[model samples]
Target: MAEMILTRELFRHMCEEQEKLDTHIYRTRETKAPSLKSLDIAYTNEANEAIKELQKDWKWWTLKERNRERFIKEVADCFHFVASMANQTRTVGYCYAAIDHEYQKVSRISRECYPHEDIFYKAVKGTVQESIASLIAISEALGATTDEIMTAFEDSLKKNYGRMATGY
Candidate 1:
């Protein structure tokens, strides 16, 4: 299959849609406030959830059976929150650029490396945090293809657009 590409326009729209969904849901709940917490807290929590999904104490052979779908969903959730955080901070462009750049680096490494080698760890380059590097690595280790991630993002954007304006 041809590689899936996420353009800046799509990223912006996804973030906008997610924000709208958040607003609508919060408004409909009546008691829940609309203001999102600090991005640091949100990102950390989402990343932790993704990590937990991957860290299920199953045998290596059973890992796919036990955690694949949940892990993918958690990764998607991370993307959603990350996009929202970027939008809130007016840094969506930077966020997209960074992700795209890192993704290209990973792709190049994957193309050049042996399958059994630790491509993820090897893909890490200057200035990238250990945690972020791990995330990029784990994403590949889990077989989360770029196309799959892009599809999840697009689906999320559509879902968010379907929500009521006040989140109801």
Candidate 2:
């Protein structure tokens, strides 16, 4: 058999392993019956399990600090949930493009605040709702119209999110 290239598929496989680890962690901690069997529900269950494990460990900081594997697994769980959710919703293809569009908007704002790295990072890390507000702020600062920025954002997303099946 041909060797599989180390690409998104590899990352996804890692994500799957992390998800299983998350499930084990959850089962060890919780006794509640799982209520959902849909892919979406499964994703939520796994994500919640990771969160619960992290929270439990967090109450004992020393335990979390000592368990590096657990820390890494938690991060992987978050990414796995996101990627799985995006795939299920058929939104994964557009993510890279959407992110790039967001980056440009962030970059423009960063340029205006040159030398203020904190401001730049804050702009880049804003929530989706906050991003809309940030764009408005950027427009006011750059004297461009909000409509233009939004149009660009929408166009980039549409171009990037074109449907493409990413079979794991």
Candidate 3:
């Protein structure tokens, strides 16, 4: 008699286990919001908080575990909000596209314009604001409320953080 291998079934089982782990991790950190509006508020606030922290020099210090943890948590929080909002808004893909537009503008300006600090800041800020507004409109078009759109934005940020952390 020959021994039989079940490699395909084994791979499926492993994938299922990994999914469960992902769900467990998500559930452990997620906070419940009764309405989509609340989720959006949470997303915007959390993103703001993360930006503040990122601006701090202490945030970049490797010795500060608390700061690192806080950064990670804030990003994760933003992610949750975004996911909820995207699902509600149906504008997830469009929002990402808008972000790309802003990034491209920034890059173009960075290369064409001389290294002027104030001008760079103005350009980047203006572009980001425009992108956000356009994304908001897109989200609304998808039948999403303001809150949902904000949440989706946060979720996009979180996904980006994950990629950075993993060096992907």
What is candidate 2's local distance difference test score?
A: 0.38
Q: What TM-score goes with each of the models?
A: 0.57, 0.29, 0.37
What are the RMSDs of all candidates, in order? 6.0, 16.5, 16.0
Most accurate candidate by lDDT: 1
Decoy 2 TM-score against native: 0.29
Candidate 3 lDDT score at position 145: 44
For residues 1-168, what per-residue lDDT tens digits would candidate 3 score against the true structure?
111121223223323433343354456546332367675566567655543433433234444333433443454444455445544455556544554454444433333542333232332244333323322322222244434433433464456457545755
Residue-level error in angstroms, candidate 3, position 106: 4.7
User: Cα deviation of 62 in candidate 1 (Å)?
Assistant: 11
Model 3 stretches astray by more than 4 angstroms: 1-34, 57-69, 106-168
Give the poorly placed runs of model 2, Cα more than 4 Å off. Answer: 1-37, 56-66, 96-168
- Which pairs of residues have clashing backbones in candidate 3? 82-151, 82-152, 82-155
Per-residue alpha-carbon lDDT of model 2 for 15-89, expressed as tens digits? 354345335435655643333245345444433443343343234444443233332343233344444444444
Sort all candidates by TM-score, best to worst. 1, 3, 2
Q: Which of 1 and 3 is the better model by lDDT?
A: 1
